[model samples]
Target: MTKTLPLRSYQFFLSIIFLLFSAPLLAQDEGEEEKPKLTLGGALRFNYNLSSWKDGQKDRGGDFGYDMFRINAVGTYKNIFLNVEYRLYSEAFGGGFLKQGWMGYKFNEEDQIQVGLTQVPFGLQQYNSHNWFFNLTYYVGLEDDHDMGIKYIHDSERIQYQLAFFKNAEELQFGSTSEIDPSRYSYDIAGRNKEINQFNGKFIYKLGKDRNHQLGTSVQYGGIYNLDTKETGDHHGFAFHYEYLGEKWNVKAQGMIVDHNPITPDTISDNVLQFGAYGGTYGVAADFNLYSLAVSRSIPVEIGPISNLEFYNDFGFMDKAEDDFEDSFMNVTGVLITAGKVYTYIDYAAGYNHSWLGGNYVDDFSAGNPDAKWEARFNINIGYYF
Candidate 1:
């Protein structure tokens, strides 16, 4: 069956497109436009890990391996601009894929529109956490998610807002396949159900003497199409967040609720949904509430090769809606060291019923073990960017 956006959403999207082309022309300045410019850069990263669950690896010291290499490009001409990033990883880790690619037009200094694969504009901008692993929100496709969409952003002195509509998640192929493709960067619904016709809105208000304090909220709604049944379901998420950026200290806090209702066959339980990324697919609780808090402090150091140090602790908890389902928890204590073009992250991450930490990949977030023990991993990631 053919998929389409809701009538109201379709109309709204067209209206924005109309404005994108028409409004920018009127807003152009009379002076000569700036010359076009393009910049290219990339990074190489490696990792070392020691896991409590892996006895053999722990006994043999630890495993150090290649993580990933990524290329980034940004270009601009007049009011049109483009940004793209492609990543290459080991075949065991999702091979290679486009992380993000988008072309945008500036209506003015304070307003702009982006088209193609772009960020959903939910939660905090750029990132909600200071660590490499991020918060629990990242696991469930709520953080740093990109999709095929159009987004409008307004940046002002005291307030900022964004609205976006995503037609679907990134597609690796044109037609339906027997199995979900897991070779991608961002997590999304990838089993029998697919994400489509999603809408997101976010607003932020800045306060404090130096405008160092920011409070924001985000909301998302979308369709979940079950390929087997040829039926479309729905999902929605809501979040409220706050951030404080001090001279050398930073704090971030957020609370969110997510619900996924997919129209699957009767044999499959609706209490869980399947999500995939990084060359694997796993189950996630269909309905849950998550809370996250992170704090960080930066210190200028005079070490031979280290110029600065950032210490941080990030904590997140997920409470499932089903009474019998066990909760999930994660905490990461780490320090980031910066020296020239090289950066290193040293982290001790622990989790209970968490996917990457210690829990079973298939059922940890769905029908989690009530008696599961906490799992921990000591990891160090080093990357050089140019």
Candidate 2:
């Protein structure tokens, strides 16, 4: 429902009256004898891929020709959170809005306040990890690209802060055409049919003597309507980041910028799409237990160079940055190796334009399939925890 005016419609009806009075504070206070403590959980993931191309031919490994599928779920209490996702990405339209959802709220211990539909923070390993359905540009579980509205956060020990607002994740990937490499890269991202609005903010710090070696920053702004421009011309986004998180050794660096305008309307346009582009990246991950069998390796400068050798004790990873429709500049990378729980390992990548192919992968969507190359994925799952 994105058609002119109503900018934030009075803060979207005051956050729907605080979610209808926060639904009676989720009931259960009563005399308050330290009862209201809840923590339930759920998670499942499945994935597959097969690649082959022809049509025009050049893109050696993939261009939406092969095959794919995925399923996901998540839930948390205390601060309040819930999420679900499903996909059968056979490639092409990428996956055609399968099923993805998110809800959140958690304003303390630092701070937090959430809305609905999620993803699209593009860093800190996609916000904590999940591997954006195989790193499809692993901005970390990918653009996680979901939309609805409202989000705020603050965390401390050193410090970190976040802010968000949305209305469209209508298939996050900036434009729409799902171009992993369109001949010479491409983007015309338009496929919301209204409901596009966004805002994002982030900060993190740790200066003096070893605060786990840290420094971070982020800012995102959004809007992409274009009811023939009467929607006051939407389409715009900006991002910047820096990182260094350590326990055993971890490092990351980031960048992003986009602005979509000029009579933008879904289903490809801009004559063939090409709005804005900027990129930067650097990555390093290290953790080894060996006495208990734990391993890891990462070289991220835009998807390329990955190594994981694990028997497992525990391991984790994340990455996020997205704007599909092939406008160029994407991020996603993920890894999880856990042995304490039977067995586990996962990986995915869809990143390129690390300021300009620093690690290379998407080489112009095959230029019509010039024996295309660049389609990666890996998954291994075994579980428990009730």
Which candidate tops lDDT? 1
Flag regions of model 1 displaced more than 4 Å: 1-5, 21-34, 176-180
Candidate 1 similarity to native, TM-score: 0.95
**lDDT by residue (tens digit), candidate 1, 100-124:** 9998898778988998889888887
Per-residue accuracy of model 2 over 147-227 as CA lDDT, tens digit each: 456666677878777776665544344444332221111122322223355566667776656776556655554554544
Best by TM-score: 1
How well does each candidate superpose onto the true structure, as a TM-score? 0.95, 0.30
State residue 157's C-alpha deviation in candidate 1, in Å: 0.7
Worst 10 residues of 1 by lDDT: 172-181
